[model samples]
Target: MPLRVHDTRRREKVDFTTMNPGVVNMYVCGVTVYDLCHLGHARCYLAFDLIHRWLEKSGYDVNYVQNFTDIDDKIIIRANETGEDWRELVENNIATYYRDMDALNILRADKYPRCTEFVDDMISITADLIEKGNAYAADDGVYFSVESAPEKYGLLTGQNIDAVRSGAGGRVDGTGSGKRDHKDFALWKAAKPGEPTWESPWGPGRPGWHIECTAMSMDSFGEQFDIHGGGHDLLFPHHEAEIFQGECHTGCSPVVHHWLHNGFVNIDGEKMSKSLGNFWTISDILEKVDPYVLRLSLINAHYRSPIDMNEQLLKDAEKNHTRLMGVYKAALELMGINCPPLPEGDITSQVPLVKSLGLLEKMAQGFAIAMDDDFNSREACAKVLGALREMSRMLGILEGDDLGAYAQHCVEWLEDTAGSVLGVLPTREQTLVEPEEDPRRAEIAQQVEELISRRSSARTAKDWPAADAIREELTALGVVVTDTTEGPIWDLL
Candidate 1:
């Protein structure tokens, strides 16, 4: 089966054929670093990260580029409010963004181009738009001529242009008042007092938010690329403007072949946005729950569907994640794999060596089928759980055994599929605690070890009731306790 993706431009799922076979050039619109990232930011990146991992697993060399709007109106405003330099503010947030995303295990983009790095390219593109009559310089700034590419505009959203034109009247910045039409958007904004400015052909100004992406992407990839992705909120003006400027520059019909947009993330049934005052930051949530649980809560839903994020959703994700991790650890341990205790448990034992040939192959097929059809992660996750269950049953027949070649192969495949590809499972190294990890986590580890020690003492004294109480307490804290000849082991739920 061929891999399929839902192209926002066509508004349907289509087979994904890279413009260049065996290589994927992907650009995902990234953070505008004025504040800490939120759930909405997490969802957008998680979806694209899933897609990037899947593509690489499928044997395509992927060159991924995600950008940062390091210089923006929001950054400036935030800097002024905090009495920090605008550049310093952006730098701080960029570092914090990396911290949050690293905790989630998202792979880093090949390049993270900041808007300030490509002002020269922005200037060149703006000049071409003016020469081609696609843009014009106003008293305050240069604005894109919406009528210049009338036929191509609004192609992605499919919204009525007339209605948009009417709705947009006076909704744009006051600077756009001088545009040829009310719907025309700014390409460059003349510097205001105390704001960052760069010398441009039009005047001393900064590039508009939308134009920054085209310049950055074109610098990294060529005129045409495989996939362009972002949140659906950018579908209208941000992305639509990219299409207009890119196509007008090179005479290419579509600057990017596929347009991928992840759906909105909500909090308590309302859209989660910083402006809405109901948004939750990724850092805050990470302190309360595991990052895997956070990732699961986001990916559990179809990427193109809205998910209402709440406490229950995260609790449910934690439960499912714990269950899968428990099974995964037990399956590994059953093959005589040894490790430190976690918060989950498992067991199956008693039989002779049997051929487990092609077990992994069977699971891979179903998984690929689900993921290929428009990257259906919900269905793909189902495939993963089903595979683990079958493997667990197979392990049930063996007692204190060293896994045979086929069983080891099955185990390796499961690890790669779950850990590397989906990024929902921890690698062996990750499962072990790092000495330099957060102090809070170290304290939690100490607390868990103390509980385990007391439980051990109770069992040695043969105090069954006290031992059971500690075990029950551990379970309530989302830890699964297991006992073997070596002693008691636990996993985090």
Candidate 2:
């Protein structure tokens, strides 16, 4: 099947008929960067990366954009709590987010625009709204007239706009910003003391939470684009607001061709939250497990399905990741020794293995079909995994010259599709860093080395308790010692 994906707009499977054939303009909402990224953030971005990768593999040139909400209420609050400048906090966390995502092999977006940096564009858009009589400035700030747009403003969230208006009206009638309807959201907020401010047409203040996305997206991707994606939670007021603002700003029928929302990463059966104390920072999990394993586990379930975060699930993900890698390695080896040239005339016997390319092609086709059919990543992932397993049996072993060659092909294919296109895979260097150990730490390393030698002697002599005690001591010192078929190898955990 051609690149069919379920467009959330129509609520049906449709081919991703790009406005321009062979070129796709894709955009996804990125992190706000006030805090460390959580598992929920990881799943959303990773799913897009896969889509980006697969598209590139399937021969479409994708121009990807992910924006950062740097200047927001959360950032300001986080900055004050930590005694750091708000902008500095945003920059720091954004850097950290990049590092974690990079380690997980997620590709950097082609453009990562920040809200604060695009103040002028925001002013221009806000001015357009007021000029069109769709917005008005009040005593405290400027608000978008939700009533001016229409009563059907809650189409995205499927909630009643009138109910939302009546409920929000009584809460904060600060300084008499007379909104025609209670559902009218802010476009600009009047500057509060000690908060960041930009020179706007309304006054020196920041863009409102929802307005940032509309302004930045229009500035970067034009009035309409192929896809707009974010967390499921944003489907309501956030996304709905964007649609209303965009359509008002530009006389467009649909602000986005497709709307894709990934499901939440729940902890246990409940939603993860700070109060619940079940939220896992992506970086925190990275320290305890292979980052790829976390990603694999995230992908094991369909992207749209809720993922429960648990220790048992993580452990299974690690094992499953290793198995997938092993299979990929095996396939590469087999293809290296016996596979024919790409786009070449081939003979028989290798058909089952070589023809497995057709299976992979089918899986790719199925992936597109499922994706077009409501972004069904669950079924698409199954196809990819199934094809990977079938091709593995054709290889003689997971390592050797043949395996290496086959691996190179698969890696190249993945790089072109998953890395370049999807923006999912990080670079494969294996080594993370070359460090300068502290002198005292170096001395401790030596002591650990000596202790390990003694432990090896104990193990040789079958002194089980002594060996176990020494191993435990080493582990306490932040050392991880592994016993491979080649014997013990030690490293700082």
Full-model lDDT, candidate 2: 0.74
Error of 1 at 266 (Å): 1.1
Q: Pick the candidate with the highest lDDT.
A: 1
lDDT of 2 by residue, 1-493 (tens): 5666656657766767877779888878888999999888998988887777667666888888899999888888989999998878988998999998887777777999988888788788889999998999986678888778784476676777666666785654563655555678898888999998987777788888888888878887788888888888898788888887889989786878888778789887889998999888988888888877787777767666788978888888767566655654443334455443443212232544346445556666665666555445567556656655754554544345535555556655444433353333444443223446766567687788898899999999999999999999999998878887887877776
Model 1 residue 270 distance off true place after TM-score fit, in angstroms:
2.0
Off by over 4 Å in 2: 162-180, 330-375, 388-392, 396-493
Model 1 whole-model lDDT (C-alpha atoms): 0.83
- How many steric overlaps are in each model, in order? 12, 19
